[model samples]
Target: MLLVFVLILIVVGLASGMLGSLVGIGGGMVIVPSLLYLGLFSISPLFSEVTPQVAVGTSLLVILVIGLSSTFAYLKQKTVDYKSGWMLFIGSGPGAIVGAWLNRFLSSEQFSLYFGIFIICIAILMMVRNYLKPVVIRKTFLYTAIGDNGDEVTYGYNVPVMLVISFSIGILAGLFGIGGGVLMVPVMILLFNFPTRIAVATSMLVIFLSAITGSITHMVLGNINWTYAGCLVVGAWFGAKIGAYLNNKLKAEYVLAIFRFVLLFVGIGLTIN
Candidate 1:
């Protein structure tokens, strides 16, 4: 029974890591809900004691693994915009701290209800992601990168606006244990004119940094389950690598379309449960 529980967690970690890396959302969207479901169903004695805070804390730790693994792969591909990633982290890091502190206030029912609503909203937003127009701004902080076709693509952002947006996303990340990439990726593409692939890669960097701060707070709060975290890390490490490789091969639009449906189904399930 112990072995079976461990295997179940590993498989959950693999799926969460693969999806998190592919989308840059930090796998918390899958992890938190999965842990909750397991606990709610009493799948194992270990999981039966799971709470929202514990689930979020455990998920954040796994997200750190996902972020590190994916970021390393993106670095080798030279797709990561390090400057932008660092700048975004400036806001997200502090916000993550605040969010982690706030998570202690929520009950399990509140957490589930809020998370379900958030996921549904994100799914709706993703449906219209491609249709949105990029906001045109003067190139104040310009960046140039080679596109998939080997053409030079230039992008830029307003630092103040970017910082503010990142801070808001960071709070949500800490509060929900998401990496905030679901929102950040679209914000980069639509508001900053970032290439899709670049946004996804760079988002991982920011997620990695924010997860560090968020997880630390959770750790201090005694929310983490080390045994569960260790099992998830083992699977997430390999899963992130596989996801990063596939990100280069697959069309993100198609992948996200499928993912949106999954989120919708999961969201509705959570809401009704």
Candidate 2:
């Protein structure tokens, strides 16, 4: 059983990490929901007891490791914006602690229902971004927290705005065990007017910090499955690297489309199930 779970973690981890890196979204977008659905009784006949909430928690636990590992890779390339990274940390760090604590008070059914809705919303948002359509209401705020990592220029927009948004991102990270990239990347591009490259790079840096904070908290609560986490990450490492390799070859719009498709499928599955 342990071995089986380990394999699942690695496979899922690799896919989630790699695809996430390519798209500037956190792996949790893929990891959390997939695990939630898979844990549901409907996903597999044998694993009915695995509730969606457990899957969300478990997915968060594994992605913590993936975030740490991904951080090293980004840092190695000198691509991380340490300044912006810290700003987001400063804003969101406290909220994350609070959010993690709140998770204990919530039930699995609540997490599942909320999580499904969140995914569906995210999918729609990604589509809007890809099309360059006027975004009706982006809850995302601004943080003039661009990292100064060499000549690769990225503008920091409205510092005051960013501070507010940054805090919110932190809370989400803590509560959801995400790096807030799903929310961050879009805001960075739309609000800050950053190019695709900088936004993606920035998202990775933010994910590293938020994910580490979240994973440590989860580990303490004993919600993480080491064996399973390892299994999922086996694939995560390679997939992220591959995504990074292909980043220049791909466009953000196309990546967003894929995310939309994945979310739609998952959303439909939830409705039918």
Scored by TM-score, the top model is 1
lDDT of 1 by residue, 1-273 (tens): 678878888998998888888877778888888888766556555556789899898888899999999999999998899999999999999998898999999998888889899999999999988788888866569988876567888888998898899999999999998888999998998898787789899999999999999999999999998878888888898888888898998876777888899999999987887
Candidate 2, 214-246: lDDT as tens digits: 666766776564544556667876777766656
What are the models' TM-scores? 0.95, 0.80
| CA RMSD, predictions in order | 1.5, 4.9
lDDT over C-alpha atoms for residue 10 of model 2? 69
Model 1 RMSD in angstroms: 1.5
- Highest lDDT among the candidates is held by which one? 1
Q: Where is the poorest 10-residue window by lDDT in model 1? A: 39-48
Model 1 segments more than 4 A misplaced: 41-45, 148-150
